[model samples]
Structure formats: structure tokens, C-alpha cells
Target: MALDLEGYLIDVERARGLEDIQTLILHLRDQYGVDHIVYHWVSSDGEQYGCGTYSPEWAQRYVDKDYLRVDPVVIGCFQRFHPVDWRKLDWSSKAARAFQAEARDYGVGRQGFSIPVRGPNGQFALLTVSHDCDDEAWDAFTLAHQRELILIAHYFNLKALELEHARAPEPIKSLSPREVDTLTFLAMGYSRGQVADMLSISEHTLRAYIESARFKLNAANTTHAITRAITEGLIVVGGTSRAADGGWPGRRTPS
Candidate 1:
């Protein structure tokens, strides 16, 4: 079945709970003619939330085995700010190969694309689509849908934040000047080392600033903190509007 992307997005935006997210992924799987579509997130405070089309048995087994510690997708995506093709991730390790084989046996697909999303307070997540298809076919599909998929990922992240806020509203914290500078450089695509040099700060000092900012923003990681800062208008980047008048709290925001 052809995916009515326009309609699907409406459904996505209308989703009211985690269960609704699961149902939407099921619909997306069928429409994309894919084996699965998944969105999984881990919050800064250690809460986990996810919705996907993978079979419950496989999902359970994965948890029971603690495969995440060795899952190449998780590891690879955590270090990246861009979308990734599964084939590009490391699979040379024996453990990874074994895991991949088992996943395939459980109906996982051979071709996949994942987008990593980082949210405030160290929250991390991945949005993924997978399919069983020849390499050429998979490539073509991704080429055609890449932009749409990216948009979907961003919407999912934003909606997830809204849901989180609804469940527990908190005060909004403003980033410190140093934190703002660090995140701005990062969002602009500067490498950590480059940023460190540009700021005339040692790498260690830079890391300290980043970690402090992450804590203040309640972010799950540096990238998440940066995203949160931008979204909340703690810092201006590239002429983007500072639409956020406020945001979530942990530390403090200047009035």
C-alpha cells in the first residue's frame, strides 16, 4: 500500500499517547512496504519509551539479552548527528554479527536507515525504518524518501518532548553564556576539537562546559543539550528566530 504521508503526519500529530505512537508505526510499516518502523528513546533521568512494529518476542529477547551494550546501531548512532545507513555501521565484531543474524531470523530487515535525535537533559532517541529488499531497491527508496523521513523524525522528537512536558511540567532553565557558545558552535557543525580551539579553551574545559550545560538543561548528552538550547531560544544561530519565550527547567534562565 502506498503511504499517504500527508495523512500519516496528521495522525502522528494527533497522537495522544505512547500507544498511539505504536499504532502509527504499524501503519507506517505497512504503507512503506517495510518490515518495521521504530522510534525508541531514553530520557536523561533513565526513563525509556518506545513504539515500534518489531515483534514483541524479539523486542523482549533483545532486552533480556542486554544486546544494547553491543548493538552497533545504538553505538554508532549515538556518536553521529546525521542520518545513517545501517550498512555503514560497524558489523565486524563477532557479537554484532551474531546479533544481526538473530535479528534477521526474527524478521528484521536487511536494509535500514536511522536518524538520531537528541533532546534536552541528555535524552536520546532513534527513528528507524527497515525493509527486506535488494541493495539497489533499498537505496532508491531511501533516496526518494530521505527528506520525508527526516521531517518525520523531527516531528516525532518534538511531539515526544510535548508529551514529556504534559506528563510532568517543569521550570525552564536558561543556558549560561559559555554553554550557549558551546552549543552554538556545535549546532553550526564544529567538531569538538575545533570548537575547543576556537573558544581558546582546552578540550577538558570544553567538555566540562558541555557537561555542565547538559546538566542545566537536563539533557541526556551534548547533542541533546544543543538541540534543546536552540529549540528553547537560549541561543540564536544562523538568523533563526528566537520563538521560544520559555522552556523546561532544572537550573535557571535569565528573565
Candidate 2:
């Protein structure tokens, strides 16, 4: 089914608290005809918060078993900056395999897809949809709704952050002009040396600018700084870099 992103955004903006997000998850789960829809994120400070449509029993079991340590989805998604299919994640370890079987026993799903989200202040989150379906059906569903799901993931994260700071949003300091240029060229697919040359600066000067921008954006690193810049409208690359890669060039896999 086609998602109404405009309508969804309106509803998300109307959300008063986490409870409202829980309701939204349920609605989206049903609308997508998926068994579960989850949004989980960890703050830079290691604080975790989330909303999802999983059964209470499974949720409790997951916590009691400390499955977070063994869950490949969480482990893999933490290292990635793009949407991923469950099959693509490594589930070969004995502990991981056991966790997978238990999850299925609890009706977690036979198939899943997750979108990794990175936000300001180095926050990391995931939006996942899981269902009990064969490979072909799952592939078809993902192809049909992937873009909408990505939009939904970001919108959901925005609302979650808003509610997390309901009193007053932590103000985002503006990037300096040098910082802006550094990020723009990087996002435009320029190598650091190439960007330094284009900006008429040495790599050392460019590195300094990026580190400053990273601090301002509260990003973890250079790639994160570029992506955060794009998402926050701090800089506009206009796909000059994305076109070359056939995708966003700033995607990261954390070490």
C-alpha cells in the first residue's frame, strides 16, 4: 500500500509523548501488514529509548535474556549507515543463531528489514519492519515501500527527538564557512586532497575545519558530519556527489 507521508508527518507532529509514538507504530504496522514495527535508538551517552509493536511477552523475554548482546540486527545495524535486510547480516555465530531461533519462536518474524538512522548529538537509531514471509514476497514488499520507509524512519526520529527535548531543543550552532565548504565538497564525492585543493587550502587546514564542524554538529566523525550537514540543511550538496556514487557517498560503517 502507498504510504501518505504528508499525512503521517502531520500526525507525527501532533504526537504529545512516547505513548503517541507507540500508537503510531501500531498503526503503521497494521497499515503495512507487517508483524512488527520497531524504532529503537541509543543516545551518545549510551541511553536507550524506543517504541514498537512487539508483544509484551517477547519484549520481556528479550530483556530478560539480554538478547541485545547477541542480536545480530542490533550489532550489525550499529555499524551501518544504510537500510539493511536481515539476510544480509551475519547470523553464523552459535549465539546469534540461537538468538534468531528464539526470536522466531516468540513470533518475531521470518524476515526483516531495518533502516539505520543517525541524528545530531551522535544519536543512533533503527526503524525495522519484520514479517513471516517467503523471500520473494519480502523482496517485493521492500522494493515497493523502501523509499517511503526511509522517509518514515527520519520523520519518526525527528518527532522522537522533539519529544525527548520538549522543554527546549538544544540549539545547533551554525557551521563556519570553512566548515561548510569542507562538508559540501566531501558530500559531493571529493577526496580530502581534492577538496583541499578546490577550497584552496592544505589538508591540515581542511581537517581542522571538519573537526570543528564535527564538534558543532555533535557528530562522531567526518562521514557523520557530512551526513548530518545534509540532513540538517547546514549545507547543500545537490547530489553532485551522490550522482557519482549512485547513492549517498557519506555512508559509514563504524569501526
Give the alpha carbon lDDT tens digit for every residue of 1-255 in model 1: 566778888888998988888888887777788889999786654456678988899889887887777789988988786989999999999999999999999988898899998877677888999889999999999998888888788778888888988988786566666777888888889999999999899999999999999998899988888888776668667743243343334433456
TM-score for predicted model 2 compared with the true structure: 0.64
- lDDT (Cα atoms) of all candidates against the true structure: 0.83, 0.85
lDDT of 2 by residue, 1-255 (tens): 656779987898898988998999999988888999999877665557688987788888887787777889988988888889999999999999999998899888999999999898687899999999999999999998899889889988998888878756677788776787789889889899999999899999988999899999999989998888787666767744323332334444111
Can you tell me which runs of candidate 1 are displaced by over 4 Å? 44-47, 171-255
The best candidate by lDDT is 2
Pairs that clash in candidate 2: 188-241
Separate clash counts for every candidate: 13, 1
